[model samples]
Target chain A: MSDAAATLKSLPQSGGFNNSPLAQWVKANLFPNWWSTVITLVLTYFILKFLFGALSWSLFNAVWSIEGTDTEVCRELKGIGACWALIAEKHRFILFGTYPFQEHWRPALLIVVFLVLYGLSTVRALWNYWLGVVWAAGLLSIGILMWGGVFGLRFVEQERWGGLPITLMLATFGIALAFPLGILLALGRRSDMPAIKAICVAYIELIRGVPLISLLFMASVMLPLFLPEGLTIDKLLRAQIAIILFAAAYLAEVVRGGLQAIPKGQYEAADALGLSYWKKTGFIVLPQALKIVIPPLVNTFIGLFKDTSLVLIIGIYDLLNAAKTSTIEPKWQGFSIEAYVFVSIIYFVFCFAMSKYSQKIEAELSHTHKH
Target chain B: MASIPRSRPAPPSIKLSLSDPVVRAIVFQVLVVGGVALLVWYLVSNTMANMEARKIASGFGFLNREAGFAISEHSIDYSPADSYFRALVVGVLNTLIVAILGIILATILGTIIGIGRLAKNWLISQICSVYIEVMRNLPLALQLVFWYYAVILENLPSAREAHNPLPGVFVSSRGIMVPVPANDPTYGWMLIACLIGIVGTVLLSRWAKARQAATGQQFPMLRAAAGLILGLPLLAWLAGGAPTVLDWPELRGFNFQGGGTLTPEFAALLIGLVTYTAAFVAEIVRSGILAVSHGQTEASSALGLKRGLTLRLVILPQALRVIIPPMISQYLNITKNSSLAVLIGYPDLVSIANTTLNQTGQAIEGIGIIMMVYLTVSLSIAAFGNWYNKRIALTER
Candidate 1:
């Protein structure tokens, strides 16, 4: 028995090819058949080639930093390697736009405030009645910081504001203002009243049927035509209104989805309680409906955030515009790839974070609903 | 007027006051309608005042005037001397070209990626997931600019040194050029043959289904359909004398001459739109496929159907019911998002309209035309989706 035990221990483990889990996994997944093996080899070849190419171009061969818009190295690397030196040189201008280089700290600080507010909102526990107060205060600060004329801080005009802060402002204000209007529209769309429903349907469909670019074009050009003579709306403000209107229409549909998902019994229960229309919707219907739609609401916000880039077309210098112009200087002209990549990463970070958070909330919501 | 045996008037059940639901609803509707009309009236009056001040014409009469601007790419014959209406048509055609091609390509690529997301191969799945996430997260505007500036303009060689990855194809910073059939009447005949084949196939399939139900016998429908479609096209092409000559692009002076050209702007727009939309399409497809239960596969397999047959008859038909409604919306998204062609200087509807608006001071008319075209297209897509959804929806007694 002792001899047999020793022999067994000495022998190689049966059915273990090299005792490597990775090799076993590869065998099962990558090369289960001759056709699969061929695919595996081809895909591996191309993927490896691309991976190395991108890695070397972006990290290994790239010129990372240059002093004060200097030339030489970046110009030589041009196509072979990324010119990240341009990003370091023009990052401030790309982030803050033409908001007076000396007052850069103001936008920078406001960005910090925005971050803090976003962080606070991201926490699940803080999602209560106080959320409104936090947002109101946050937005008010944004306005004050942006147009500061008091407290020895210089006042920056709206036109001078651009880049990351402007993107943040548009997305934030767009969501903030649009959400209530969207709710109202959603309610109107679902109302028993025919005339009300018709008007709501027409407005929502009219806005949804066209691209946001058309509305921006309307805001930039035709909005003036709809204004009283000799009176003017600021370009940024007009764009903001367009964004709000566009977002409200889309959000209304999303909100209507939530409203539809609510059981008819809930509406009946509210009605049975002798609640007035406003009281019923406000206390009972809307709270439950809005909660069900939070994930999609976040998703809509992401779309709006990405869409803010389109403001560049109408000459509002948002982040994309700032990035585009960063490379317009003669020395930096050919280095748009770097600038775009930098801004894209910024956009990606914000959007990715929001999307991931939405996914998390969606999972939680489904889990709770299941329970 | 009190009739014989008329019951005493039912005790006034519903109060005729603001507290009553019906009364409140009517009041709300009237208030909303009045508010909307008042707003519209205010805007219209303001607009007229502003138009008078600016001396801007409001109607589409400008569409008849000479465009006085050249559209670099157009499917139909057009010139700088063409009317603005003709120019708009060119823009619309350009938009349709990109939108249709984008939809087709995005669907193909998206379906592959979507399937790959559930692949047994770990590396392939991971790669596909990464592609979807990265592409989906980035702003499409940023992607379009990246394609335009970074890929096309920055890296591509000049016209003389254009890369030719395939025979009769050339890619340069200026554009891509591919050979086209040299004025082929034979191709049109082939197209007509293909159409006939499609109709015949449909009829054959209907007869096969009826026969199968009647006699419990199966027909080789797939093989017959393929032959009728592909073989008939080939036969027509041969009968019409297959034209071998192609209008291959050639380097002459600075740019490629002859052949068909896809401008850098168009190519970039197509690439960006397709790539960006594919990510979302992939997610939709993945969800759709997942929505079909594993039990379905097992049930079909137990019934002794081959894998491919099971996929064709059982899996796809079910998955498509879930896939199609979302897919239609995505197609609509492509059409709408193609408006971004304005930025990269593609002569899409929006871009050309912007130019016309600038030249003629017809901003309102231009914007109205754009909205009307897009709204009609959007509504049509929605209607088609609704119809298709009804057709595919499961029915019961």
Candidate 2:
């Protein structure tokens, strides 16, 4: 009875911080020791200093707006404060590049369609054959929304496409096209057939060895030469193809990791059940492998999304290019700082959301495994 | 049971039908190879037709032609009058400069930040976490432009108003200008001595390690290595009369003329790549350290090992096994990413090749050159990584 009482008494002290008061928690975490206090004090000073400087520059002393494209107000406060008037003036161009000004509603609506598709895809219950059909429908509507010639809607050539919609298209289409190709490549690399394995290895390695810019340069400049006479691909399509091919190589490696992770017994079990290679892989192997690899696939997707910005190098105006163009105008020439900051926040938001989601999923996966 | 004679089933005979796996494998390989060959033939024929129609010559002969355009920066002496090959050499060297410096700096910074992320101080860890996330989530290209436009070009004043951030270092829109050692032959001897000292230190460590295994006695190996590395170089410098003259940059007409300078383009590219890559490196490092199980540290502590010895003998070796492969890939990433120098006009290989392709209209050859150079570098690094990994791999037996 004495021993039992002693064990019970020690439980609360061992689980110390679970229901502790705020002051105790704060003292333990933030100022647990002299060194920690020193760190907290130093970090607090710098953070406050930066916050004050940034607040004054971006909010307090900023030029919010100027009437009628006037530069005098912004020019006066060039270094002293932010010229958010530039962002307000150039947000349209930055959001939707050379697309017809009157038809901005289409791209704007296209952005909404993308968001809805993303939202649908994110829900766990929707991950089924219906999801693929939904994606197909979503992609078709995306095409129609981007290029309309029927139903009293004006047709807009892809040449005029730019900005955020283009960024999304490049990233989304890249992943959509690359995922299957990556799976096939991964399967081929693991196959017993030497020729197929060699081909897959060669493709993946050649694509991955060089930087994306080199491939973009090839797609933009050399791809024309490789095509038949009188046949030309549009710049955006060419860049999109390059992105698909590049992303597939990286995705293939990730999938290969998943493939390697499967125990030999699983493959043997499927084989003993009289399943053919394709049936076994598609019905059994892939389901388990892809499930295990989703978190890493999301990481690859984050990379792909960021890589879409490189399309600007080939003069296919993506978001970064739009921002650069916004600054080229005489009115907004010196306000690229504001332009970049604005665009960076957008990019950051997308990337951060994806990374957080990926982290959460990974944590859940590890949790299940632990249990 | 004895009267029943059981006949063994014959092993499955090979058949030419699709049901036979051997036959299927052969047929599949054939079809795939044939299809690939057909595609290659078609593309080649098309390329040939297009080249003839466009009247564009396809050969490496253009490499010998005069590169009429000027490169903004070059590691070696280069002129507009130089051959295209020489210009390419300059660009390759420039790319190497960024790769080498970026790798070194990123490794140092990433290790520090990674350790900081695990600090006992909650504020320090939080600060490190924020730094990694913010640096990583933003696109590298955007960061490069910001560094070029907002930080370097816009914020820095012109040459006349160059700010002295350090004792003899100047920052301006023109680029960074800092003091350089005056032309002295003694520095060359010192550099050679430093190289020799490095080699000597390696030999000393091998000997010390063998001695420790044999005698179980510790040697002051670090002090001995340090002395060899530093003392030899210092002795060489002292023997050469210890010249300490420096050529400080001065405002001459419109620019600083006397010192070693970093072009704005190079500075932007380097800073962007190093900081961006450091975030990735930090994550890899943290994960590697975390991969070392807590039980190993406890075991070492229970064995009466000091904290430093516990970490060195138990934790680090295991952590390194997880750390090295990813760390190598990060190095590879830095090398590949240095190609982004084109965006900021750093005159790297891609930029130089782009100019060449435009000037000579040798698209196929230009692209071929780029792929070859990158492939060679990449394969070499991969090969080296495999070798190093094998050397450090655990002996299971």
Candidate 3:
């Protein structure tokens, strides 16, 4: 009886050709039924076809070098695949539109510096009071680098600044300036003071109601009309301010959500400690509220990053606009698709990374706080 | 040694003081209000001076002037000779058209994809997730540009080489021309029949519900409603001398003439807005569905309800409560994002106002109108959402 049982047990788990985990997974996930199997097969066919087509187009037929070739070479391979040659040739113009070619290294260096600062800020170990100092120093340095006059570098005007650097500048500065304003607005909205509450509500609603494009238009056009005679704000500055105002409203709402989540006990305890309103908020409430809101804050940051593109409407030469302007060249006229795709990849990388970071933070926070 | 007892401090006089919370609050409010008032005063003075110096007339009076620029797409009758106000009205209508259509399309697509995300089919779920990720990650403006330039203009054939994918329908780089129904007299009757059928469906469903409550017997309400709606419309059309003639688009030398055409700009904007907003809507829907507790489903099933009936009767209604608030915001988002139609030269409100602003140099007035319109739209959606939410909200003591 024991021998028979052993033999039966050793019969490869009963089902034919389903002994392997791969087969088991396929059966369980892909082909649990006739309908599922049919769907899997059809989807697999189309997906594979698409993957192969994309691969062949992007890799096999794509022209990689434009060093020794011209537009004619790209034209020859036009219908077959993407003209990557166009990206290679005009990448400089696309990166630093209207900026003098000799000074390309400045913007390039600034981009790297800003990226490094961003990376540093993301490290949990770097979360301290000094981080604010670091950001301030970093932003100042970037400003000096972009505007150049103090350090004996040539003065490149704001008009000449473009590409990735400008995109980063607008987004980073907008968020940096907006964060404190957002916190204030959140507090004001929740405060017992009626006048303060009303103003905060109105400001938030007004900004939230309109599209960012309208604000950009208001900044670019109406802002000039509103300013004192002969007192001017640069197009970039006005756009930046508009972005700050718009982002602050959204951030305020998020912060308010975080604030509302804080327990009444926390407030009562702070009150019992004889803490003043400002001290109570700063020490007792805001830290915990802000901590709970980090994920949403990051999401807002990602949104602000994407929205920096809207500055293109008001004639700011951000990365997207730079790419677009590059494609306007006669030699690169037909390669807009390639240029846009490249720019899109850059944006996608930044946004995806930020979103992933937010997810990770959310997971970590939840894990630590598991009941 | 025994210590001498200290005398209680004398009560302080009740006086108006900054230390008092009530007095401090009043002071703070006055200060804030004063600051705001001063800021407003400064801004107005500066604006007035700037306007005077630049010789720029400010106000709504300029809206009466001729627009002097052509709008490519307009819902209402418009010409370059039309007043700026009329041009703006057309722009608002165009904006409304795109926003409404985008909201409808996005909701449908989003709901399907949202449900698809929860499907047991692995390939389908993965595809839906991928689509959501891609559409969400990209900026709406960039996507609009892509749809306009790459998808529509570059990939589509020119008018001369228009692709006739369907009979009486022509798609080209210029636009998509689809056969529309002729302005037949019978069409009015057919539409009226549809309205009647809809009313009948509602009454039928109500009666069925009441009967079920009283008799504990189920009715095939869906089939009956569908039959009424479809059959009545068909009968009306047939009775009114079925006007089957379609105004087919005919390809002239360089373009399709006749029939309704969806301009490339409109198409691109619609597609981009729908796809982008749908990603967000899908997430909202998924979360909303998930918010309907699993116990509810188990309980419904335990009561001998089938899967379809349980989902329809138990899950969806509860899920909709969680879904709607965010869904309204998404609708508002679609409306606002439709302003990006300017990027592709769609004559949306923002685009038309932008041109008006440029031509008339009435930037303040132009921006004011745009802001007011958007605010009105946002408020209206919020108010409607609030009403619906209140209606559907779970009531408890």
Q: What is the C-alpha lDDT of each candidate?
A: 0.90, 0.89, 0.89
Arranged by TM-score with the best first, the candidates are 2, 1, 3
Where model 1 places Cα greater than 4 Å from the true spot, the runs are: A1-27, A30-38, A66-70, B1-15
Better of 1 and 3 by DockQ: 1
Which tens-of-lDDT digit does each residue in B259-303 have in candidate 1? 999999999999999999999999999999999999999999999
Tens-place lDDT digits, model 3, residues A26-55 = 667897776788999999999999998888
When summed lDDT is taken over every stretch of 10 residues in candidate 2 chain B, the lowest stretch is B1-10
Lowest lDDT 10-residue stretch of candidate 1 chain B: B1-10
Each candidate's DockQ score against the native complex? Answer: 0.54, 0.51, 0.51
**Candidate 2 residue-wise lDDT, B46-136, digit = tens:** 9999989989998899999999989988879999999999999988888889999999999999999999998877778888999999998
Write one digit per residue (lDDT tens) for candidate 2, span A1-371.
85675466445564445446875667677876666788899889999999999999999989989998778898888888999998888899999998999999999998998889888887878899999998899889889988999878899999899999999999999999999999999999998788999999999999989999899998999788889878899999999999999999999999999999999888888977978788999988998898788899998999999989988889988999999888887877778899999999989998988899888888888888798
True contacts kept of each: 0.80, 0.81, 0.72
**Models ranked on lDDT:** 1, 2, 3
What candidate 3 gets wrong by more than 4 Å, as runs, is A1-17, A67-69, B1-14, B199-220
* Model 2 residue B24 CA deviation in Å: 0.6
- Pairs that clash in candidate 1: none
TM-score of chain B of 1: 0.95
- Categorize the docking of model 2: medium
Using lDDT as the measure, the top candidate is: 1
